[model samples]
Target: MKTSSPSDAPRPGHSSVAALLQSQGALIALVSILLFGALRYDNFIGWQNVSDVLSNSSKFGLIAVGMAFVIMSGGIDLSVGTVAVLSSVLAARYSNYGIAPGIAAGIVVGLLAGLVNGVLIARFRLMPFIVTLCTYIAARGLALIISDRQTVSISYEHGFDTVGQGDFLALPIPLWIAAAIVLAGALLLRYARFGRAVLAVGGNEEAARLMGLPVVKVKIGVYVISGALAGLAGVIVASQTSGSPTEGVGWELIAIASVVVGGTLLTGGQGSVLNTVTGVLLLSVILNLINFENGYTGGAHLTLGSYWQTIARGLFLLAVILLQSRLARRSP
Candidate 1:
């Protein structure tokens, strides 16, 4: 009988460590940042600042969630930001029709836009990057035309404003909505057959097809989900800012950054919804710290403005990419 040596035995702890790094790395980073901020700043631990962070993070969190799904499916939706703005424009335009109608209209527009993306890419075999880029331009123009290149205000009396600004249990309503989306996304990606198929397709499309998976349906479904979530994000933005056609400009980059920082592979087939949330919070905290630093110095010493924030974001993205590359190389 052959006897197994120490080196031949499987090392469970090693695998566990690797899994933890893969799944909760962003969470670890977030916690570290939070601790650092709390210790370094005076008001960073204040309730008001915390609330502000959660509230502001909600909109981007929602968009990032959808983008996470798309990225996991080996696809990208560059138009999500513009799509969100378009949805906001439509929601504001329909606000007078009643709250339900207003919200429904925004969601429908998102669904329709997603359908177009899905059909074009999955059916016609078009490149996702080019298709979404085209939609990005078209959606922006549509938003401009619909809102007449102006900010469309939602009536305060219609209860539509409360969806974003109101609070429950002392937390902003948008935060609650974002939490719900994240939970639902986690469940979908964890326990659903559709989720498994998405992973399969993303991991290996040809193999997925050979395995009798609904490759086209799964691909299209992810885009539809992305579009609908982006639309919901738009509605939330409209409620918060009284509606604006140009609200989500440059948000696509932020969403992508969040996904990348969350430890999700840009090549797709690997990501976590919870990690994406952590990524959003991490970026928000960093921005908040920058604002605090700027104000603390009274624009004299460290007067880093929005441009600095952009640079910081670019640097953070570069660091994450380099880390990912090293990790990938180390993996067996």
Candidate 2:
């Protein structure tokens, strides 16, 4: 008889009802929201709006994809946002050289940062939260110092302008890049041996270790993936708005929220990258719906402030978590 891996062992909170809801609820909500928007708002599902939504969500999607891997492995990286800012500054400073150089430099820096985080956590056995938190603080500070606490405008030389501004198949280039990354991530999670290892590591590290899994390598790899994606997001930011010392501030929160809302447990393991994407899209659509509401009602539906959207995001996350909790409690 086949034996269950440590992660797959019978345990509390693995309730079938809760698990099913977590796995399927996010998609259902997303579909319902889309239907509502399509009915209530004119052209809500139109191509141009869809393009804009996808473009705006692409950067976050990248970060969330990496974050998903980290979380699924029962780890967290608080530095992703600040890492993106650091990479953005680097990319902008080197933009005069050429498109490829700038992009490469940014991604390389991100990889290095991730490697540092991985070593500190896996090799040194430091707590992931504390290690990543320190990295977050340091990365942001370095970004500010390197940029002189100012925005570094890109030269846009050597076809560098095409990255963010370009389009393919009527979709934004950033969206295309983000899509490729997400697809790659999905493939890694679905069919790769490493994917199973990651879930196992997250589900029960000690058990996985007993099974002879390369726990250290798995931990290191997830962080590297997170850092690489953060770097890519930074390059996109530089392409769109140049590099600001302040870019990507608090982006980690957005990534976390998106993942959680997508039904990924904060405890790690038992999650889906595809659901994460749906969560990203759902949040984006909510923002879009909010804007449409305000436009249609001439500000009657919402207060006149940017913070409302933040509040909405917060409320949405809270609601989903509560529902998940209630369902989890109902698990028998």
Best-performing candidate as measured by TM-score: 1
lDDT (10s digit) by residue, model 1, range 1-332: 99999987647676566556655666776787788778767778899999999999998998999999888989999999999999998998888777887788788888788888989998999999999999999999999999999999996778888888899998999999999999999999999998888888888889999999999999999999989989998988888875687778789988998898888888887888888988888889878877877777433446687898879867875775566555554444
lDDT of all the models against the reference?
Answer: 0.85, 0.88
Candidate 2 weakest ten by summed lDDT: 296-305
**Candidate 1 segments whose C-alpha is farther than 4 A from its true place:** 1-19, 297-301
Q: How many collisions per candidate?
A: 0, 0
Clashing pairs in 2: none
Please provide, for model 2 over 53-100, each residue's C-alpha lDDT reduced to its tens digit, 9 standing for 90 to 100. 999899999999999999999999999999999999999889899998
For candidate 1, the 10 contiguous residues with the lowest summed lDDT are: 323-332
lDDT of 2: 0.88
RMSD of each: 3.5, 5.3
* TM-score (all chains, Cα) for each model: 0.92, 0.91
Candidate 2 — which residues are off by over 4 angstroms?
1-19, 298-300
